[model samples]
Target chain A: EAGVTQFPSHSVIEKGQTVTLRCDPISGHDNLYWYRRVMGKEIKFLLHFVKESKQDESGMPNNRFLAERTGGTYSTLKVQPAELEDSGVYFCASSQPGRGSPLHFGNGTRLTVT
Target chain B: GESVGLHLPTLSVQEGDNSIINCAYSNSASDYFIWYKQESGKGPQFIIDIRSNMDKRQGQRVTVLLNKTVKHLSLQIAATQPGDSAVYFCAEKGISSASKIIFGSGTRLSIRP
Candidate 1:
C-alpha cells in the first residue's frame, strides 16, 4: 500500500503570503495528523482528524492557521499571512485506528518565509 | 526535510558493533511509545514501538526497552550498519489525546566505517 504523501515538498513564500500544504493519507486510514518542527526544536503536534471531524486541534499555533479534511480522505493545512516564524517542516502522518498503531509519515513540506 | 535543530546529539558507532540510543520522555501518562528513524530528505520511518504494559520489545535486530519507573526509553541496534545512520526520534502517545504522538528532540546516529 502507498504511504502518506505530501505535496510541494518545498515551498518558498514571502511574509503575509498564503500557503497551503496538502497531505493524502494511506488508504482506509481513519486517523490523520499534522505536526511541525521548527529550527532547533522537537516535532510538535498541530491537529488531528478522525474522518471528516477534527479529533483535536489544541496545538494549532494561531488563528492564521487553518486545516480541513474534506470527505475525510485527504487534508489541507493553510497558513494565511504567513510569518517568518512559520518557516519549518510540516509533516503529515496517518495511522489505522488502534491503541498502538504506528503512524506513517510523509516526507513533509519545507516552508520558507522571508 | 528541513533541519529542525541547531545541534542534535549524535551517536557514532563502528560497523558490526552494537549501538544504543537513549531518550527520555516527559509524560508518565503515556501508554504507547515509538521510535522513528529519519534519513536526510526523508520522512521519519517507524522503527519499533513499546507499550506501557511492557518493558521490552524486539524487532529485526533492534530492541526497544522502556523503564516506566524513570520515564526512560532506549533503542539498541545489533551489528549496526552504515544504512542505520539517521536521526532517531522517540515519540509518546499520551493519554491526553487520541493517537497524537509527541516527539523528542531526536538523536543523530552516525556510522563509522
Candidate 2:
C-alpha cells in the first residue's frame, strides 16, 4: 500500500499571496490529520478529519488558514494572504479508524513566503 | 498547557555504539506514546510505539521505554549506524480521539564514523 502523498513538494509565494496544499492519504483510511513545523520548532497539530466531518480543529492558527476534507477521501489546506510566518513545512498523515494504528505520513509540502 | 519535550536538542554517538534519547511530557493522562524518525526533506516515519499499559516495547534494533511515574519516555537504538542518523521525535496521544497527537521538539541523532 502506498503511503500518504502530498503535492507540490516545495512552494514559494509572496507575502500577501494565497497557497493551497493537498494531501492524499492511504486507501481505506478514515482518519486524516494536518500538522506543521515552523523553523526550529516541534511539529504541531493543526486539525483532524474523521471521514467528511472535522474531528478537531482547535490547533488552527488563525482565520486566514482553512482546511477541508470533502467526502472524506482527500484533504486540502488553504492559506489566504500568507504571511512570512507561514513559511514552514506542512505535513499530512492518516491512520485507520480504530486506535493503535500508527499514523502514516507524507513527505510534506514546504511553503516559503517572502 | 500540555507539552512534550526532549532532554537534548542534539546527540552525537560513535558508530556501532548505543544511543538513548529522552523525552519528558507534562500530561500524565496521556495513554499512548510513539517514536518517529524524520530524515531531511521528509515526513516522520513511525519507529516504535508503547502504550501506557506496558513499560517497555522493543522492535528490531529499537526500543521504547515509558515511565509513567515521572512522565518520562526514552528510545534506545542498538548498534547505531550512519543510516540511523535523523531527528527522532517522541509523541503522545491525548486523552480522546479529538485530542491531536502532541510531538516533542525532537532530538537530532548524529552518528560519527
Candidate 3:
C-alpha cells in the first residue's frame, strides 16, 4: 500500500565526498530504477534492478557511481569522490514489471555538492 | 542518446481553460508513452499513458494523444487549475518490454488564475 520511499530528502556534501542514497520500493515489487536529473536537464536513467540482480546498468555515468540491491529488497546508490557534475536530484522508482503497472516514485534525494 | 523532446519548453494557460503540451520522440520503436507531473522538490507522478496502437486515451482530467507517424505525443488538461502548475514531462518507454521510461526535457506549465 505504501509507495516507494527514499531517505534524506535533501543532502549537502562537499566535493570529493562520498554519499549514499537509499530507496525502498513497494512491497512485492521486483523492479527498481534509479534516475538523475541535473538542473535544466532531462531525467536520465542511471540503472535498474530486478530483485537482487542488476538488470541494466548501462546508464551509469562513470565508475564513481555504484548501485546495489542486495537480498532482493531495497536498493542503494553510492557516489564516491563526488564531483560538481554529480550534483543533481537522485530519484528512485519502482514498478510491478507488468505491462502498465505505472512506476511509483519517491520524493527524490536532492544531493547538492558544494 | 535518444532525444524525446518537447515542442515548447514552457506553456502558460489561464485557469478554467484547457492546456495542451506537446512532445516529439525520436525512437520510432518506442511503443509506450507516458506523461508525468512533477511539482517542485518532488519526483515525477504519472498522469496518463498511451500505447502505440491507440491514437487517444483519456483519464480523469487528462488526455494523451499519440501520433506514431510523426512520433509526436501530446497531453491535454481540461479545466486547467493553478494546482496543476508544475513541470510536465513526456516519457517514452523503450521497446525492451522492461518498460524503461526515458524522460523528455519537460515543460513547465504555468496556470494564470
Candidate 4:
C-alpha cells in the first residue's frame, strides 16, 4: 500500500504572502494529523481530522492558519499573510482509529518564508 | 507545560557495539510511549513502542524500556551498524490528550568505524 504523501516537498514564499500545503493520507485511513517542526525544535501538533470533521484543533498557532479536510480524504493547511516565524517543515500522518495505533507519516513539506 | 526531552543531543558509538538513547518525559499521566528513527530527507519511522502496562518491549534488534516511576524511557540498539545512524525521537501519549502524541527533541546517533 502506498504511504501518506505530501505535495510540494519544498516551498518558498515571501512574508505577507499566502501559502498552502497539501497532504493525502493512506487509503482507508480515517484519522489525519498535522504537525510542524521549526528549525532545531521538536515537532509540534497542529490539528487533527477524523473523516471530514475536525477532532482537535487546539494546537493551531493563530487565526492566520487554517486547515481543512474536505470529502474526508485529503487535508490542506493554509497560512495567510505568512510571517517569517511560519517557516518550518509541515508533516502529515494518518492511522487507523484505534488507541495507540502507529502513525504513518509523509516526507513533509518544507516551507521557507523570507 | 508538560513536555518530553532527551538527555543528550547526540551520541557516537563504535560499530558492532550496542547503543543506548535516553529520554525523560514530564507527563506522568502518559500511558503510551514510542520511539522513531528518521533518516535524512525522510519522515520519522516507528521503531518500537511500549505501553504503561509493560516495562520493556523488544523487536528484532531494538528494545524499548519504560519506567513510569521516574517518567523515563530508553531505546537500546544491539550490534549497531552504519545504517542505524540516524536521529532517534521519543514520544508519549496520554489518555487525557486523546490521540495526540507529544514528541521530544531527537538525539542524533552516529556510528564510528
Per-residue lDDT for B16-102 in model 3, tens only?
999999999999888888999999988899899888889999999899999888889999999999999999999988767565788
Query: Against the true structure, whose DockQ is highest?
Result: 2
Error of 4 at B4 (Å): 0.6
Against the true chain A, what TM-score does chain A of candidate 2 give?
0.98
| Per-residue C-alpha lDDT of model 2 across residues A1-114, encoded as one tens digit per residue | 889999989999999999999999999999999999999689999999999898999999999999999999999999998999999999999999766778999999999999
**Per-residue accuracy of model 4 over A4-83 as CA lDDT, tens digit each:** 99998999999999999999999999999999989958889999898999999989999999999999999999999899
Candidate 4 error regions (>4 Å): none
TM-score of chain A of each: 0.98, 0.98, 0.96, 0.98
Q: Which 10 successive residues of model 4 chain B have the least lDDT summed? A: B93-102
The alpha-carbon RMSD values of the candidates against the true structure, listed in the order shown, are 3.5, 0.7, 1.0, 1.1
Lowest lDDT 10-mer window, candidate 3 chain B? B92-101
lDDT of 1 at A91: 95
For each candidate, report its DockQ versus the true two-chain complex. Answer: 0.61, 0.76, 0.69, 0.66
* Sort order, lDDT high to low: 2, 4, 3, 1
Winner by lDDT: 2
lDDT of 1 by residue, A17-95 (tens): 9999999999999999999989946889899999989999988999999999999999999999999999999999999
lDDT of 4 at A5: 98
Worst 10 residues of 2 chain A by lDDT: A95-104
- The ten-residue window of minimal lDDT in model 1 chain A covers A36-45
Highest-scoring model, TM-score: 2
Interface Cα root-mean-square deviation for all models: 1.9, 1.2, 1.5, 1.7
Per-residue accuracy of model 1 over B7-93 as CA lDDT, tens digit each: 238889999999998887666688988999998888889999998999999999999999889888899999999999999998888
For model 1, name the residue pairs that clash. Answer: A40-B4, A40-B5
Better of 1 and 4 by DockQ: 4
